[model samples]
Target: MKLVRPLPAYLVQRYHGWKATTFAENKSWYRRLAEDGQHPRAMVISCCDSRVHVTSIFGADQGEFFIHRNIANLVPPYRPDGDYHGTSAAVEYAVTSLKVAHLVVLGHSGCGGVRGCFDMCSGHAPELEEETSFIGRWMELLRPGYERTAGCEGTEQRLRALEQQAVIISLENLLTFPFVRAAVEEESLTLHGLWNDIGSGGLEQYDPESDDFLPI
Candidate 1:
């Protein structure tokens, strides 16, 4: 039952090339990070899309950001029922232990997970609606957002709205954590919502004051 496999030849060679070039050039920096331990200034929770590059987007170095990638960048509500919560665990560590100053929930355009959820909720993707489907269960978190966006006239508009809703919902759920709420209220931590347009190469930030995603 070996579910995992080794890297292919091409990827292995590419990794070694990167190690020689990038790692070799930053050997001292990497060593220092290992020795001192990581103290990232921000915690980024983004989608598992290969196109959404957080490091490149922020021009951040290795030890600058603690990132967590999950489907649709969705954050479930605070449920302390002794279940395995991977995203919650990361949020707990980043907020409580790492004391990251900023917690960013990054969503993006052309997200397959979002599209799948949209289809599932709309009765188009019956497979995802099954109880045995992990994606369907995980996507339940976005159902509220779907409700809001489902009224849109066009399919494209609905999907895009749902993408932004994912960011908004995640930001709301982040506050459900007591530590997260306390940190924000005391000014130790700030929460940010960002949506990236994959095709247009544009970044829009959610503004609580105006309740809109304004371009940055």
Candidate 2:
């Protein structure tokens, strides 16, 4: 608790500035959201990368999307091991309680987590190979994704492939949850996979029929 403290001066200044501007302009909308609670139509699972801004990309308003973020935007297959499951817990709440109509697995280029997974799997990151490495264990969830892109030509191509694969893997894992599967089967929920090129600002969506990512 010693490390926890009040907001820094710069952040406090920015917060007040936003409160005086963006917040002031939408006070009524904020008040309604606070009173009625959120009922977002979509749930987005995206990477923890700071550069990948989900709300900005969608031009979404506050409470428009229920979002969960983690390393590489990875989703593990449903496992009822009775341990701490942050991402799974969020997905459960979004699907069961929030009843979000859409579930989006979003990935992006130049993701440090995806690069870490590629390095670890390629025997380049020994630090991540340690059993106690939390990131390593988490990145293991995307190992199968790396395997799928093993035949890719260049390192960049392989890494990019893994990035897209992260989205595909998460989409596949979403179906492992019984509630998610049932919702999809009943046409109550839809799953989507998306990858972004950070530099170019280009978005690609996974097409199940074509089994490839296509420009959206």
Candidate 3:
């Protein structure tokens, strides 16, 4: 609590600018959203990378998508051990309460989290091997993905494959939740995996039939 500080001056300035322009133009829309509550059609679990603009990428408006961001966009397997699980909580709320129709796990190219996992699993990042490293523990969730892509021919190829695997792994984990599985089984909800190339703005979606990420 003692370490807490006020918002940065630059961010405050930016907020004021937005309030004057965007808020001013969309005042009624914002008011309606506030009064009606959110009814997002989809839940997007994406990487915490600043460059990955989920709203801009999909051209979605406010209240259109329930977004949850985390390192590597990972979703841990369902374990009702009474432990604190932020991502799991969000998924539960989105699926049970919000009743979102689609759940999307979005991964991206050149993800630092994936690189850290790659390095850690490759035995290069000893620091992440330490038990006290929160990042190390978090990145452990993606270790299986690293194993899947370990035999790729080059660094770039392996990294890209691993990135996509992160999405696949998360999609698989989502099914471990009984509610999510029930929703999917009832055909009321669907799961999707996507990988974005931040530099080129290209998007690829997972095709379960082909077992590949095809460009969209």
Looking at model 2, residue 143 earns an lDDT score of 93
| Per-model CA lDDT versus the true structure | 0.95, 0.95, 0.97
Native-structure RMSD, model 1: 1.2
- Superposed model 3: Cα runs more than 4 Å off: none
lDDT of residue 83 for candidate 3: 93
Please provide, for model 1 over 1-216, each residue's C-alpha lDDT reduced to its tens digit, 9 standing for 90 to 100. Answer: 599899899999999999999999999999999999999999999999999999999899899999999999999888999999999999999999999999999999999999999998889999998999999999989999999885788999999999999999999999999999999999999999999998888999999999889999
- Clash pairs, candidate 1, are none
Alpha carbon deviation, residue 146, candidate 3 (Å)? 1.2
TM-score of each: 0.97, 0.98, 0.97
Better of 1 and 3 by lDDT: 3
lDDT of 1: 0.95
Q: Decide which is better by TM-score, 1 or 2.
A: 2
lDDT of 2 by residue, 73-181 (tens): 9999999899999999999999999999999999999999999999999999999999999999999999999999989999999999999999988888989999999
Off by over 4 Å in 1: 1-4
- Across 48-163, the per-residue lDDT of candidate 3 in tens digits comes to 99999999999999999999999999999999999999999999999999999999999999999999999999999999999999889999999998988868999999999999
TM-score of 3: 0.97
| Backbone steric clashes in candidate 2, count | 0
